[model samples]
Target: MELFNQIFVDPFVTMYELPDLLLQTLWEGFVSGTLYSLIALGFVLIFKASSVFNFAQGIMVVFAALTLVGLHELGVPAYLALLLTLGVMYLLAFSVERLVLRHMVNQPDIILFMTTIGLTFILIGAGELVFGGEPKAMITEELGLPTGSSDWDVFGGIVIFQHIDIAAAVIAFLLILGLAIFFNKTRIGRALRAVADDHQAALSVGISLNQIWVIVWFAAGIVALATGIMWAAKSDVSFALQVVALKALPVLVLGGFTSIPGAIVGGLIIGFSEKLFDLYWGVPILGGGTESWFAFIVALLFLLYRPEGLFGEKHIERI
Candidate 1:
């Protein structure tokens, strides 16, 4: 009975007694989910365009952030460093298309996937050599992001909201909006969609495969930079940020590999579920440390029921 009470009854009781804490936990989850969605968005862009599972996306995030910080450390202004980082990402995209994907064209999917894994190693080695293996603080003020917090008193308790968290949420929403417009309304976006639908057919219609690959990769790089800055602000910019890539796999699974909106929704689901479970049950009963595997377990269960994910269309592949 004690175990049952602790498992089911006590957490609810605590939530009821301290509603503000519950709200605070939810807000934190939302912030985390937003970041997860941003990372997953990078994956979707590459996969949708090229049908390649780019395993290097995580390292790309760390590399982009490190580049920005490294440039700033060299006495470059924050905004100038940001522009330089974008230029670097564009060059990377172009070089990748010219030197890597160009030769790998018409290769098997497995081959493309392996190529990305190799790219991941090269990026890691290069990043470590250039930036060193030390963690650096995110220059939040230099980038003009908000700092400090706001507290709300309600239901006989105080709920604290960090300004940076609020800014992150708003920026994430705007990014999504802009991406939707870009993909749906622009000529380049139409070309991208065509390439995604059928590469050969797109090529037949005069759509340049090399150009599309460069554009898609460059777009993914920009998303990585945004994700890096936000994530580094929340924590420290470090090679350890690469591990968050593992965490993002669960989000991708939950959201489906091809659906953008699904990524956002799936992230929120994982984020909220993990946070609430850790606070209410895991810490109290399981001796803590549940957040690490919580999202994966949920994703596994979700996939068992709806393999296509919540928003992804069902793909019926006839053998």
Candidate 2:
């Protein structure tokens, strides 16, 4: 007990003597939570529009990253590469709207989900063919983003922060803000809501279902690109990063497919709780590696209590 206390338990209990580490951990959790919310937003958008869960959003993240880097490798300027990447996403949106989705509009949700899974494979193979399977550096400083770290002395300990992390948090918050407005305060947004409510009824009206799909998919692509950039800044840009995107699943489960604010709040809750529990409990009491499934276990246990989710509409049987 004494050896365990000295090795694992005491390090965190002595956090008071290490206020900076505590502050740093909190900041990192917040940043991770924000990024998770962004990924969740992509899922929510397509789900609301078409009533199909877009399982391919993770690959979209990798696709966007590959697009950006592949363009740069071909002698395009960094800024131009970003612009061209957005154009590629836009073209993809249009093509899918005109091609695959137009044919599959009335398909079952399960079928649509499987289609997305297939699309994931397509994107993975295409990205690999275009960019090769290598981890590439993000053009952060080239994009004039902040770099290095800033430190503050708090209680005789330095609370250090990555400038890139701060930038990512700010950019993600702004992106969410923009999406909130687009969804809540626009004519097209109302049309989208109508489609979500009843696709056949929406078609009966003047709303162009195909156009709406393109817009929503392209919007999701933009978010994916942003996610790719921020994530690449932290790790390497690789197809393997799609695995990280899976973390957003528990976020959606805790949030609810239809609720945007729920995604954000749920992500923050999961993020902070995991960090706290893994640090204060898992490492000390258990033999670590708790992060692998900590969020899933919390989500599953919470789901037993509130199956419909905190923000999801209550499900009641109609007699």
Candidate 3:
């Protein structure tokens, strides 16, 4: 016990004693976690509608960011460039449905997953060729996002929070709300749910598979765009940003790949725990870089007890 205290427990106590920095770190983690959820939501939307895992969702984030910045670099207004980039994402949705989903309509899930993995390589090559492989500034000021920071005094300590982070958190919240409403309150949303429930049955009942695929992919595009903007504001837009997409795998595992609410809760859980662990234990024990792998490890441990996830549907298959 004494050895453990000397090595791990005492150091964490000293670190936690800094309430201001702890609060600030948690705030940052929460904001980042929300953005991760947005990206994961893209996977949820497409997976629900088409059962396609969309390995390209991460690169879609980078591609959207590049298109936005590229259009602005051509002298378009920031807002206009944003709108046009959205149009690009829609175009992608249209093309994907027409070219990929149409041909692979009745294919097995493994095949669809493979196709998406192939598509990811294609997107990576195309993005590098068209956008250049260098990291670019996100044009945060041009996008009209607030910058800088503010501080609040608590317990004689000042907690600093960034305005950009606050805006990102707010925007993520609104996006989640919009998606929730879209999934639960609208006609198209209902159609989406129906298709997810039974694709062959949906087609038999007169639902156009093409239209549903396009719409669901477009919704995913919207999610990709919002995630790109916030993440780009935080760090420069680059292929590196695509790696963050891997974070969504654990989020999906925790939230259930099919549940929107699951995505949100899972994202916050990963974000908070990773930050907490990194803050209190990473340095005193495992060096650092815990953020890179902590979420998956946590998810793996959780899976030992609940393989279906917190909100995933239970299986009732019987012979």
Candidate 4:
């Protein structure tokens, strides 16, 4: 009975007693979920266009951040560094499409996956050589992102909101909205969908597989840069940050590998549930530190019940 009370009753009691805390927790979760969705969005973009899992995406985030910071450290202006970083990403996309993906066209999925794994190592080595292995602070102020916090008094208590977190949320939302419009309303976007459906057919239709690959990869790079900046602002920029990027795996699984909106919804679910569980039950009963594995467990349950994900299309093929 005591365990049951601790498991279920106490959490609700705490929530009832502290609505402000609940709101605060929800806000933090929203911020986290939005960033996770951003990272997962990179994955979705690449996979949708090229059918490659792009395992290097995590490292790409770190690399993009490192490049921006490194350029700034070398005396480039922040905005200039950002533009240069974007140019670098575009070069990477073009090189990848021309050198690696073009040669690997029509190859087995495993081969493409393995190629991305190799790319991850190359980026890691390159990043280390270029930026060193030390963690770097984000140029948040230089980038003009908001700093400090605001307090909201509600339910007879205070809830603190970080300005940077608010910025992250808003930027993420706008990025998602823009991408949705681009995907649904642009000529290249239709070409991307066509290539996603069938590469051979798309090529037959003159969709330019090479151009699509470069565009999607470059788009993924842009997402990586944004994710890296936001995440580094919250913490520090380092190769270690790539591990956190793995959290997007669960986000992708929950949201659906190919659905943009599903990624957003899935990220929020994981973010909210992880924070809530850690605060209410994990720390109290499980001795804390549940956030690390919480999302994956939730993702596993989703996999078991709804492999197609919330917005993912169910595929039926004759066996």
Candidate 5:
């Protein structure tokens, strides 16, 4: 009975008593979740268009950020370096489409998946070589991102907000909104969707598979750059940031690999739940360090009931 109370009841009491702390925790989770959604959005963009699981997406995040910071350190102006980094990412996308996806056309899904894994290793090696395997500070101030924190008094307590966190959330929302509009309202978007549905059919209709692939990959690269910037602002830009990319796996599992909105929703669910549980329940019961596995555990339990994910299409088989 005592254990049960601590497990199920004590956390609620703590929350009720420490509402300010609860609010703070939720805000932290929201920022982390938004970042996760941004990464997952890149995955969804590539997966929806290509049917290939781009394991390299995570590395792409690290590479983009590293490129941005490295360029800045080399005396390139911040904004100009941002543009140059986008150009590099675009070149990378074009190269991948030309050299990788071009040859892998007509291959099995597993083959395409394996190709991405290869791409991951190549990017990792190239990143370490060029970036010297060191962590770099994000140019938040140079880029004019807000810093410091704001606090609000509520319920006789104070809730604090970081300016960077607010900026990140706003940037994420704008990026997502822009992507949503591009995919839903643009002609190229229509062509991309057509290709996603049936590559041969899209090709027969005069859509160049190579062109579509380049565009989709470039789009994903752009998303990666944005994610890398926001995330690196929160921490140092390091190769280890790839772990943040790995966190997207559970988000994809929870939200469905092909869903944009699902990515956002799933990210929030994972971010909020993981932090809340880690702070309130997991640490208390498991002696801390539960955030590491919380996402996968929650996703696994959810998947056992709905393997299709929260928004994935159901695959019904006829007997």
Candidate 6:
């Protein structure tokens, strides 16, 4: 009974007693979730259009940030470096389509997946070669991102909000909204959907697979850049950041492979649950570190009960 009380009852009691702390935790979770959704969005874009899991997306995020910082280190202006990075991402997209994906058309899904893993290694090696194996600071001030914090007084305590965290949340929300509009309201968006549904059928209807692949990959690249920037702002830019990006795997599993909204909802769920669990039940009972694996545990539960995910379509096979 004491263990049960400590496991469940005490956490709720804490929440009731420390409302301010609860709010702070929720806000932090929201910010983290927004970033996770951005990363998952990159995954969803490529998977929806190409039906191939892009395992390199995480490294792509690191690479994009490294490129931006590398250019700035060479004395390029901040905004100009940003533009150059976009151009670099575009070149990457074009080169990938022309060189790798174009040749692998109609290949088995496993082959395509392995190709992305290979791409991950190539990016890591190239990034180390070009940028060296050291962490770099993000140019937050140069990029016009906010700094410092504000405190909100409530429940006889204060909740502190970092200006950068607020900026990150706002920027992520805008990017998500813009992408949602672009995908839902554009002609290319319709074509991409058609291609996602059936490549051969889309080809018969005059959609160019090559063109769609380039566009989706490019879009994913843009997302990667944004994610890289936000995450780098929170910490130093390094190849190890890719491991953080791997957290998106659980996000994808919770959200569904092809769903944009599911990505958002699932990210928030993981974010809030992990933070709360780590602070409340985890530290008290399990000696902390729950945030690292909490999301995966939730993903495992989802896989067991609802493998299709919250928004994924269930394919009924007559076997």
Q: Give per-residue CA lDDT, model 2, range 1-319, as digits (tens).
A: 8767856668667676778778877887899899989998888889889987898999999999889988887899999999999999999888878878889977899989998898889888988888889889888887888999988888878888889999999999999899988988999889888988889899999899998899999999999999999999998899888987888888888888877887888788788878867776777667778888998997897799877666766767999
lDDT of 6 by residue, 1-319 (tens): 9889988799999999999999999999999999999999999999999989999999999999999999999999999999999999999999889989999998999999999999999999999999999999998889989989999999988999999999988988898888888888899988988988899999999999999999989999999999999999999899988987888888999999988898898888988889988999899999998988999999999999999889987879999
TM-score of 2: 0.94
TM-score head-to-head 1 vs 6, winner:
6
**Model 4, range 11-130, lDDT digits (tens) per residue?**
999999999999999999999999999999999999999878889999999999999999999999999999999999999999999989999988999999999999999999999998
Candidate 1 per-residue C-alpha lDDT over 99-203 given as tens digits, one digit per residue, 9 for 90 to 100: 999999999999999999999999999999999999999988999999999999999999999999999988887887788678779998899889988999999
lDDT of 4: 0.93
Q: Which scores better on lDDT, 2 or 5?
A: 5
RMSD of each: 1.2, 2.4, 1.5, 0.8, 1.1, 0.8
Computed on alpha carbons, the lDDT of every model, listed in order, comes to 0.91, 0.86, 0.87, 0.93, 0.92, 0.92
Residue 84, candidate 3: Cα error in Å is 0.3
Single out the weakest 10-residue window by summed lDDT for candidate 6: 175-184
TM-score-superior candidate, 1 or 4: 4
Error of 3 at 38 (Å): 0.9
Q: What lDDT score is found at residue 193 in candidate 3? A: 90
- Which residues of candidate 1, in runs, are more than 4 Å off? none
Off by over 4 Å in 2: 1-12
- Give stretches of model 5 more than 4 Å off: none
| TM-score for each of the candidates | 0.97, 0.94, 0.96, 0.99, 0.98, 0.98
- Model 2 pairs in collision: none
Which 10 residues in a row give candidate 2 its minimum summed lDDT?
A: 6-15
